[model samples]
Target: MRIFALPLVVLASFVASAAAEYSCAGPDARTQPPTGAIVVDPTGAYSGSFHNLSEAVSNVPNTTDEHTIFLFPGVYREQVLISRLNGPLVLQGYTCNTKLYAANEVTISHAKAQRDISPEITSGRNDLTSTLRLKTNDVKVYNLNVANTAGRFLENGQAVATIIEGNNYGFYACNFTSHQDTVYANKGRELFA
Candidate 1:
């Protein structure tokens, strides 16, 4: 009998790829939003101020205004970098159960590898390669699905789903899925439920 061992990194990548292959068989079931919740619909069918998630995040003033962003059912493909938020911020996703991440219908994803960086940029950390990077304090994310679609067959380096680099941040009922570096809580006080 012959036995061959695979590296842990390779094994992890295989598992991630296997999970990625699994998809929803049909269209996502619709659910009514919470009363008075701001809605963001990609189809322009809803009364939303912005169509894209980045625009919604950008519309918010940098001051401590304390705002909440409600994302409707959709697969948003973009790299979202939130920085210098002096006040409280809440990003909510459409879900049947607010306390359970399994019912989340919103997915924010992006495909970016570490090797695609330019030479001018130094300190090429995984934060720069994240799909969603939050650099503000007092941030709360609820019932949201954040993913990095960079795939698991990369030649080098890692991809991240969410980079938490702020103080007093809380993530509740959120599903974070990625091949590598799914959730990087590097600094400050944070809570994940």
Candidate 2:
């Protein structure tokens, strides 16, 4: 009986240590401004004047709490990756046509090289890669167009617009238009159009 009890105690200690490593930046501990009216703009006064979408996401709080990151009108030229830890995040553009452009040409040929190749590929013209990669659950995006302008002149490479890798994500009034992999929704459950 004593030996069995000792093993149980050791198992409990291990479980506690593992749980501590899983830190979710809970709803109550938001480091950024609340989601109600957070905005990102080059001319605005905020924690950081983000010149691109990636900078905006970097400032967002990673937690289960719901928060919104509003982007102003501008052409954001960069690859944006939204992490899985930031669930219930929202990225909204001020206008319907606000655009996020990708610098890298997304191509099955090129993507394969990186081992991050997208599943869908089109005629060297319409590869489905967009400029944005979303990996969080329950995220919402609205009124923005994600595009890859790399192959526009060369007509070889493609662009991946948006990659959704989490569950319960939603996109409303958002336009994902790219020459290649437009939107990559991977293993996500209950994604709203």
Candidate 3:
């Protein structure tokens, strides 16, 4: 009888993967807002914090410096549009467990549909029906919940949780809650986990 030997690389790869722990924001979630970041705290617990996410996003300078936005615990009712920025953007939400999206303390919600055209949108657009719209590249969002409350209706049509028209987007430990079309992305590089 002949004995066959397995490759050493195969065994090493198995051991490395077995020891690896799956986590979006590492093992522990963020408790404190990062320095120099625009913080959004609707509860007013943090001094100088913006009351809403839209205001905080607008406050970001259009410079090629790395920027981060930390969100405190609260439900924010707004339609946010993150446009082109010169720098990389990071949106981090407060969470006790970074491993789970359900542990997120911050949620951005809006009830809108393509059928409902506004002044900004003269015609019905699939992208406009999204609760959160990202049109820029090099963006990473973590531990946040985005929801579209628009349900099944003949007039309401399909509702989207998020629309990513940007080139590069990475969403980690995030929850996109919607009955129809949870996410719609253009022809770009995107990742969701």
Candidate 4:
């Protein structure tokens, strides 16, 4: 058997490109929007504009306006995708302790995979089958938990917690839990700080 040695230049380029996808930052450096930002309180405590996350996202104009979605303490069992916002967007979770991902109180969860659903049903995009999918650039998610309960050992395959396919995306103090493809950040330059 002959050993094929990879070129040093190619190895260095791969390492550099991979390093560009990550960053290190303190919890204080996380994006902290104002309290007056658009709130999504399921208990009707904060007088939110919409009770559902999808509705709140849909209400935002797809223009160059900076928008933020503050999710109060709730277990949102829905599939959310942010695809057509032409501006910077922020999704922040309500947490008693913002310094750590463990204190996150908002959970956006779902259970679906390509093995269980037909390709046509998923619009031929298996990436969209995630619980949370972001297809727009300049997006930030902070202090939230995104989960896919579908077990990898089960017959269903390829369950994804969240899919980040956009550029300039940052996830700070966020917990993404799943058996497989917990956080699919395969497409763009992402920062999981």
Candidate 5:
């Protein structure tokens, strides 16, 4: 019995390519922004002017539909505040390895602490230094890093990397770094996957 080998070879090559792209699937997945997501890129590589996390988070419309904000590779030096959303929100960072936090390329950082915050903050002093504050529920964050650049207990105090005040929050392959008080999820059911 003579079996044609060309079909088998082509199938093998197709499977090999698909397996190799498992880490970063989808067309132009590593280079293009995700569809239906608000893109944030500091280099102005995206179509919109949502160059900063602060700008993108604030502009999210209050709707019942699921929304997502995609961040490109960069260190965004600003505070990110996610207000109460009527629906679910997703904050995703561009990463080659979506399952590893160490490979995250998007970082939201701020060099401030409780002492640096003004009296205008009404969420109590504990939240004054948080670089990223999520006040809404049903949020998913992936492959992102948040850092409070305040010095350790010596010169700075209570520099929080993130503060989540909402329920049903999922943070996957994300890193929160700071000198003190890295993350505060006092009033929420959070999952760190």
Candidate 6:
């Protein structure tokens, strides 16, 4: 019994240490933009334009500090996940209504049916989760519309437009449009729209 207990205690300690090492602190905040102008077009490369939002976010100097990504006016049809590990990130759209259209779409009846059913049934629904999942703090998105337009399918439940799980996150002049769970503001305390 003593030998078994010793091994269990050691395993528990190791697990705790590993969990503690994982942190959500973002890189040093920057007061200025990292690049002159970062454009994201479906038909361009690194010259200044990016083919996707993730590429633009990936090009940001993760180790150098905070930075900004200026996205040109276009309908970005992809799920954007902003991680907190990459320093302070600012996604600025060229136009006031630059839309980030999530591929997932949810209708009114579909949303109602899911709510009436078991939560587990809805848990398997990725479209109902969020089109944009934010895992970073101090991140701001300006003049953009994040949405999940994937209507009911046999595969899942409802669709979520945006999921905010970061602290001190701000959405300025941005629209989060969806049916149910339009914005899942979870865990993190500080959030502003």
The TM-scores of all predictions, comma-separated, are 0.77, 0.58, 0.81, 0.77, 0.81, 0.60
Please report, as a residue range, the 10-residue window in candidate 5 with the lowest summed lDDT.
Answer: 23-32
**Tens-digit lDDT string for candidate 4 (156-175):** 77788988878998898999
Worst 10 residues of 2 by lDDT: 103-112
lDDT of 5 by residue, 127-171 (tens): 767899889999999889999898785676789899999999999
> What lDDT would each prediction earn against the true structure?
0.79, 0.57, 0.86, 0.77, 0.84, 0.58
Look at candidate 4 and give me any clashing residue pairs. Answer: none
lDDT of 5 at 103: 69
lDDT of 6 by residue, 89-190 (tens): 677655412232221111111122243346666343443356777788777776666766655534444567777777777676566666656777775765
lDDT of 2 by residue, 49-86 (tens): 56566776777776667778776665666667777665
Error of 1 at 150 (Å): 0.8
Stretches off by above 4 angstroms in model 3 are 1-27, 118-124, 153-155
Better of 2 and 4 by TM-score: 4
lDDT of 3 by residue, 9-68 (tens): 677778777555433255585878989989999988899999999999999988999899
* 118: Cα error in model 3, Å: 6.2
- Alpha-carbon error at 118 in model 2, in Å? 15
Model 3 weakest lDDT span, ten residues long: 1-10
Candidate 4: Cα lDDT at 69? 89
Residue 135: error of model 4 in Å?
Answer: 0.7
